[model samples]
Target: MESEINKSPKASAFTLIVAFVCVALVGLALVPLLPVKLNPSRTLPGFTVRFSMPGTSARVVEMTATSKLEAMLARVKGIRGIYSTSGNGWGSISVNLDKHVDAAVARFEASTIIRQTWPELPDGVSYPYIQMQSPGQGSQSPFMTFTINAPATPVLIQRYAEEHIKTRLAQLSGIYKINLSGATPMEWRLEYDSEQLRTLGISTDDIREAVRLHYQKEFMGTYDVEQGASDRQWIRLALVPESESRDFDAGRIQVKMKDGRMIGLNELVKVSRVEEQPQSYYRINGLNSVYLSVVAEETANQLALSKEVKAYMDGIRSQLPAGYEIHTGYDATEFIREELNRIYLRTGVTVAILLLFVLLITFSPEYLFLIVVSLSVNIAIAVIFYYAFGLEMQLYSLAGITVSLNLVIDNTIVMSDHYLRCGNRKVFMSVLAATLTTIGALVIIFFLDEKIRLNLQDFAAVVIINLGVSLLVALFFVPSLIDKIGLERRKRISPSKPKLKL
Candidate 1:
């Protein structure tokens, strides 16, 4: 009755019960919404910008496409960092946020930035593009491509990989972006009539100059100016502007003579379009083969996605060219999942150590009930954070959760130990007041210290919630149960009083 009377004045008793129930419901309801992605970090939306310029080497790409894209992208808001890479005929740019940003918003922002800045960029650059989705989901590479070269007809091998194998693999789940490298067919060529060229005294170098002059852009140098701390420069180039870059006329090109006479290039050589050299070169199992890589949708589960991809690959082996097969494979999902699992294992070990230490010090299993309740409180609250933040159980958040368990248990130990030390009802009231006071004093430490608050926010929050729960559990629930029911049955050790020949 005394406990009931004390509890009536404090609304915490009822509020705590209501909070626990509501939070429990929230936590349970959110389970279905958690993304099943193999890499939890991959679910956060992002966009990749890609550009390619044929005949332009890597260094040229750095100066032309990468520079222009980077300069223009600098102004976009919410950008955490800009990453750029350039290779022969290709350049890729990635902008990422430290925190999860809305994917649609990031894509739209990135696309608009690329689009508006295109005209100011150097020529020969293909239109900038943003990847609509990432390929190869879960823990496996979505595509594994090995090339088979038969000296007989490499073209047939390439055509088979494309018309049959690629088409088939595209149908698999979480698989997209199937790229085939080093498979272009050999080109048929027509050499210029050197005898006719000699009759006209036209040199081969002149023929090459004529061919290049009609098609390619020639870069001019940059103009530099001094700024307060740096020098700025703008490069200039004359281009066969978009509309004229496709000009492929054979009649207008010339073969120049030593005597200054000229003859049309078409008159000396039969000009026709044939296949160009293969763009990519690859080998597998000591045999000539093309490379194929498959990527997956970012939101897909890595483990499940990899599993499905492997299953499809195994099933489709018979469909591949007899001599051709998947030679190499790699999966990002598997690596990330393994890392998350490690974090989880560490979390379990840390919690176990904390529980054992608390139980040992108390020398009472009943006291452990508080620690159990505290850990549960944290788990329940972690679910709330998961929903509020859309935090996938990423390795980073897992680390936070592990630290939080210790905090929740720590706070409970402080509160319950105080309750245990109280000798009388007045002492109980004093100890309870003291417990709340000590909590208040220590609570500020979680927030007041930046490192502690940031690194341990999860643990701190769990402790906070658990602390509140522990108090209410003690003041109302524990007290009511203890008073109305009775003290826990204690093990009877043989009376110590002069144990006479017992």
Candidate 2:
């Protein structure tokens, strides 16, 4: 095998050049297409369940929603822990699953149990809202956030976002969730006059019961009636408006008066459309603002999504109302990009310092040049294999590359030093043994369970590939290149003793 490997660089150097060219082309092409992310996903498999019980105390919320939901979800397979929070009129439960659980399967199982448990909930409890927090995105911040600052009222800004901005941005491919802060919910407000109510002998409960019975809209149920000889027709019942406004059926609604006469709702109460009581307020730079928080899909490119959002904002700038401006805030993509740039800068500085030290010890520019070339080719090959192995270019993989660079430089120096002292055979054998030892340790990491493997596999792949490539370069390419450059070991002359004529 050694003889066969030796003949390639000597007998046919062009073959090596051709091979290098092919790899270089493939490496450059794959780099751009490689999926880049900030970091590896560390979030365990889990999901969140939320519900609201309006006008209920925290203890009531816990009993009605949080505790029941937690009990139901605790039966799911691979559940690790159950956490619940109950606040005034709101309850939430978070179920953390064991790492061995498949995320998709866990979601399905959890949903099934939650749906089965829904009917058992107490009256006035809201339908459970299930949000699937992806294993990869559980800890992610919003990819981009935009604050709508307008000279108009917060209500107007919120209306603009809800009616105009939310739907448009949701249509973008990468955007999944858009949260609006400081936007009041649209609701119908009914104001009752106490004196008028007392004069009419009517109570608020009586009016509420009347509205609940006759004024609201619903698909009460479907009725099947015989339409013809054998066929049946289904009819759906829905409340239709008899008044100009669709708020309620004011005409059909009648409440029994104390005198036994039928009275209409128009006489006892005033109805108007208004914003619901706000639970929270938001302000940006001392001005009332409506904030639109945009989150990208799990596998989506954050930087690309951010750019698209910015472009969309630019296109709609002119359409915004006068004195209104969209201020960008907390762009996470830009932050990740900066972090990556810093990592790159640090890697370059590290390489330069290492090379300087190697140059001082070797005292040969030729050796330095060979080491640099070997380092470059070793990394390029590692990148090529990284794509081949179907790993992404995330922060973890980049970190692996940085570490591999140091290892490659170290191996190259070892080979060069040995070659100068003892010849090519010693260089090949020593480097091969070192590379095997390192790869053996990394291979052991692959045997770990799925939970551990997901985080480490890409990193291990990168280092192993780099070390393998370094070994090959040390054995073949470096030897051929140094010989071609006519670099040889210089002879050292011992100090000559003074010749004294006795």
Per-residue lDDT of candidate 1, residues 313-427 (tens digit): 6776766656666644556556667777887788778877878887787576666665575456546655765657444444445554665465455544554454344311223
State, as a TM-score between 0 and 1, how close model 1 is to the true structure. Answer: 0.52
Per-model TM-score on C-alpha atoms: 0.52, 0.70
Query: Which parts of model 1 have CA positions greater than 4 angstroms off?
Result: 1-33, 36-49, 55-125, 130-276, 288-299, 317-321, 373-381, 384-389, 418-502
Quantify all predictions' global Cα lDDT against the true fold: 0.55, 0.70
Could you tell me which 10 consecutive residues in candidate 2 have the lowest summed lDDT?
217-226
Top lDDT prediction, candidate number: 2
How well is each residue in 97-191 modelled by candidate 2, as lDDT tens digits? 87778878987787678667865877556556565655556245576888898766788888788778887888888776888877665544455
Question: Model 1, 70: alpha-carbon shift in Å?
Answer: 5.6
Models, CA RMSD each: 12.5, 10.7
